[model samples]
Target: MNDETIPQITDSHCHLDFPDFEGKLPDFVARAAEAGVTRMVTICTKLRNEPNVRAIAEAHAPIFYAAGTHPMSVAEEPMVTVDQLVALSAHPKFVGIGETGLDYHYTSDSAQVQKQSLRRHIEAAQRTGLPLIIHARAADDDMARILAEEHRNVPYACVMHCFSSSADLARAALDLDFYLSMSGIAAFPKSQELRDIFAAAPVERILVETDAPYLAPPPHRGKRNEPAFTAHTARVGADLFGLDYVDFAAQTQQNFDRLFAKAAQYKAAA
Candidate 1:
């Protein structure tokens, strides 16, 4: 289909600063636009990389960014402070607080530091009024408990970015009025269980992403992913929700606008 007929969507999470896209961002952004992925949030997984990631957003109108010390890197990176994260939010394109949360899959040893970092990111989200982007893995119980506990202290918005977690965790996040971002992983053949979890969610709370350089949906699976492939995952999201591609795309755009209000406002003002 042509641009007018294409169903526009946003890649709510990605990593454009990764070496996989180095020196090729313009082409990737162009390809994404061509594929109806009109906007994308490129994430900074380490505090030190925030400048590079922020520069990418500053250089590309269609790109926005979020920064946090990822759970896996919590052991290696300096623990992020709420003040540091809150300070970063001053940038017009700095949109979210994290890609934080628990990840016992590989970094189980650093659980305490991860938890500490997660809370700081949550507090940053609370302070900045930006959604906390989460990356939950095998630590669902702790993840859910902390989120629920802290949310009770002072509610904060969040999205389980590239979510491929348990139904219980999904429910916990949804219970707190948080969003669940569908990445290319949900489009995998063996991801029926994940799809089912998403299928059970309120459509108004669903968003879509690519998680580029990883989790490329079918037809591009096992290859480096990019924001352009968001349309592929979103097509599957449309099918799972029993809605036409355009309608589902529009719904997700509405959901994104509601959650990432800063980006939405930027677009509106532009």
Candidate 2:
């Protein structure tokens, strides 16, 4: 196929800085380009890792980045202040505020600390005018409550990264004009119910991701994921939205543009 005929998509969330692909980011990004995944946002889950994560984004034109203390590490890392996150956002490639939110499944013991961390991240996003990247796990109720509560305090844009939560949480996130990011898990055959939720959502409110070095889509399931696999999940998204590959790809890029405007604008100016 002619390269120009291929549609473009973005991997809204990934972790290219991790050791899984050490010394091989250029090759992985090349693979993503071949797959029509022309862009990605590599998340920095710890402040201490921000420099390295930012380097990854700086090293490749197709990449952008976000940073915040992940929920699981809330207790282990020093608590982040809103001012610190706000300061980081001043960087040109720093596109969002967090991979933060409540994750009760494995780290329920630190729920209170997680909430405090989440609130602080939310404040940073609010003050910086950047979207918040949320990671919701088994704490849907609290997650929903806190997100809604935080919005009431001060509104900010966000995307429920790798969203596979219940319909209630989906509804809550959507009601706030936030977005739902589709990941490899949504393409799993047994995830009919979750797919239904995406089908029920507005196309403009949906974004596609690989959550790379994590959830690889079908045909690559049970394998280590990378931004390149985002194309596979996006093909599934096309099916759910009842659109062709090109149209679906266009719509998602537009949705991503709307949610992560900093990334879109940065790319445009480049």
* The candidate that achieves the highest lDDT relative to the unseen native structure: 1
Candidate 2 regions exceeding 4 Å error are none
Worst lDDT run of 10 residues, candidate 2, spans 1-10
Off by over 4 Å in 1: none
Q: Ten residues in a row with the worst lDDT in model 1?
A: 1-10
Residue 23, candidate 2: C-alpha displacement in angstroms: 0.5
Residue-wise lDDT of candidate 2 within 1-270, one digit each (tens)? 666778999999999988998999989999999889899999999999999999888889999999999999999999999999999999999999989999999999999999999999999999999999999999999999999998998899999999999999999999999999999999999999999999999999999998889989989999999999999999999999899999999999999999899999998899
- What are the Cα lDDT values of the candidates? 0.95, 0.95
Q: What CA root-mean-square deviation does each model show from the true structure? A: 0.6, 0.7
